[model samples]
Target: MDLVIKNGTIITATDTYKADIAVEDGKIIMIGKNITQTEGAKLVDASGKYVLPGAIDAHTHLEMPFGGTTSADSYEAGTRAAACGGVTTVFDFVIQRKGQGLIEAVEGRRTICDPQACVDYSFHTAITDLTPEILEEMKESVEYGVPSFKLFMVYKKEGLMVDDGVLAKALEKSKDIGALIAVHAENPDLIDMRIEKFLSEGKTSAWYHYLSRPEFVEAEANKRAIHWAKAFDAPLYIVHLANKEGLEEVTKARNEGYEIYAETCPQYLHFTNEVYKREDGRNFVCSPPIKGKESQEALWKGILNGSIQTVATDHCPFQSYEKDWGKDDFTKIPNGCMGIENLYPYMLSEANKGRISFNKVVEVCSTNVAKIFGCAPQKGTIAAGSDADIVIYDPNKKFVVSKENMHSDVDHTIWEGIELKGYPVMTFSRGKLVYKDGQFLGTPGHGQFIKCKGRK
Candidate 1:
């Protein structure tokens, strides 16, 4: 045995109990009561603490380029923040440009991430152009352990949007290749008309970003994507589902036996479009902009009733300075914010209250995310033979959200001043203590790539 964690209430996506967990060669070797410690083995007494599998953030665009500026968090800084926040694995997007081959897009991203990640990571190839060559290359990515693909229904101007025919072909490719297709559902034509109208009427404020792409935009696209995926018999995963309309679409599809899933983010759940009224509201600008408070309640209903399966941070980071670009023109603001470092604490804090259960949090934050991305049983479990990626959470640990106390290179946090009752006191990734008590103990490149299995 290399290490032993004793007297901790082990939590799984479906179960919880006090037990002793043993680790060897970066895997959980034994989990039982009163296991005798071997000589030279490090012992950690997790009394009164909750031991859970480290979170797996399924959505992040680390160091991605958008709006003429790169996201502030590089792979090193992003993964380091992920570790500090008790996330053991993250799936960052690899976008294929118009002239790039799938291999070039994927390998290029890997070249940067492989040497910089501080926690295990994987890639989700985003399809901007579904050419025959690119369609064929989808199989190569699946063979290389990336079994999921991302498609955007919006972003037409940025050259990232694909029309319905392209989406049909992409879904066919995913179905044939045994891969999952995740869509960012927002009606682009509607948004274009709305944005033009708003600008023509001189309604160009930070808040107009939300007004231009309202919940109905997302809902309409969600239904359309579901229809397309269903017609092609391809499984669908909707990312960043914000309002009731999308959740209703996902729920209906799921009930009709269509293979479908959806996820919501904390920004949508906690902060509403009202944030745009603030002076610094430009910082909250993101695609499929945050909706009103009713939408937040709708997302919670989806979670409570099983319509929504995960709560991943669409952690596309940008600093306030970059956000300032859109000061006079809301559309110029880089569309993303920092959240990889807050994924675990924000959810755990919600669980600490009566809003959600610890078990449900484990499901959304860890277990189901791994399953959805096909990294499961390896990255999301704490049982024997699973990777020793675990977080010891102190239920009583108190803290408030602040950039000064965070590990991300960014200078601000959207969650500033929000107090919390629980925190990840110790995080172990593959048997290594990577983070402890607000300090990062691991170096960049310590993390490696996880080979995800095909979904659907």
Candidate 2:
């Protein structure tokens, strides 16, 4: 054994037990009671703490270009923040260029992330131009170890939206290639109409941003995407699912035995559209804007009832000055929030309050993401033969989220001042201690690019 973590309560997706885990060469070599210690193996006493698998944040946009500017966090800063939050692996989007192939986009993204990533990562191609040739490249994409593709159902003006025919064809091709199709489900045409109406009426505040994307806009698109997925018998993954109606559609399809999976972010679980009325409401602007209280409650139910499979952070942030671009016109505000470093702490805090079980948090935050994205058996679990991606969680640790205490490069965070009782005190990525207490100890470029396989 090279390292041993002792006297901790191990929480997995399905079970909770007390055990000591032994690691050797970045992999779990043994897990049991009172494991014999090696002569020179470093020992970590995890008394009075919970040992959980390192979380997998399956959605993020670090250094991503949007709304005429790139996001504030670069790959180094974002993954360092992720490590501080106990996220050992991240799946970032590889946005396709106007004339680039899907695999080419992945390769291009590697140049930016490969040298700076502080934790293991993978890519999901976001197709902007889905021609016949691109559709044929789906198989090669899967073979290239990136088996997921994303399409926007909105953002028509930005040239990111795909038509219904393109979506259907991509879904069919993904199914044939054993790849998963993820969608940003929102009705673009309806949204455009609402935006035009708001601008015409001079109702251009951040509140109107929320109104432009009512729950039905997202619900209709989710239902329509599921309809197409069913027609093609393809697996569909909905990212950042926020509204009740959309979740209902996801539940219905899942109940019908379709492979419909949905992920909800921490922002939707915490804030609502009421934030849009704040003086700094422009900072809260995001697509499919946070819904009302009823929708928020329904999403919690969906989480408990198995409709929502994973919880991630759609963690794209802008500088406060950049967000200020939409002070008078909400259309110019970048649509995202800072939550990668807040995701695990917030969920575990809620779990500490008994809103959810600890095992369930582990399931949604780590296990389900790995299973859905095909990082399982190697990551997501603390068993023998699995990578030692682990977090030492202190249920009694208290902390308030602030930009000063966070690790991202963003000037401000939407999660500021949100106090948390439970937090990850230490994070180990593949047996390497990357973050502990409040310091980052890992080197840049230490993170290898994860070649993700197809989901089972």
**Model 2 stretches with alpha carbons more than 4 Å out:** none
lDDT of 1 by residue, 305-405 (tens): 88899999999878898899889888788999788989889899899988988999999989998888888788898989999999999999999989999
CA lDDT, every model vs. true structure:
0.91, 0.92
Q: Give the range where candidate 2 is weakest over 10 consecutive residues by summed lDDT.
A: 447-456
lDDT score for candidate 2 against the true structure: 0.92
Clashing pairs in 2: none
Residue 233 error, candidate 1, Å: 1.8
lDDT of 1 at 424: 94
Clashes of 2: 0
Q: Model 2: how far is 61 from its true place, Å?
A: 0.5
> lDDT tens digits, residues 1-456, model 2?
889999999999889999999999999999999998899898999999999999999999999999999999999999999999999999999889888998889998999899999999999999999888988888888888899999999998888999999999898888778899999999998998998999999998999999999898999999999999999999999999999988998999999999999999999999999999999999999887999998999999999999999999989999999999999998989898888888888999999989999888989999998888888878888899999999999999999998899998998889989999888999999999999998999988989898878754
TM-score of candidate 1 to 2 decimals: 0.98
Candidate 2 C-alpha RMSD relative to the actual structure? 0.9
Inter-residue clash pairs, candidate 1: none
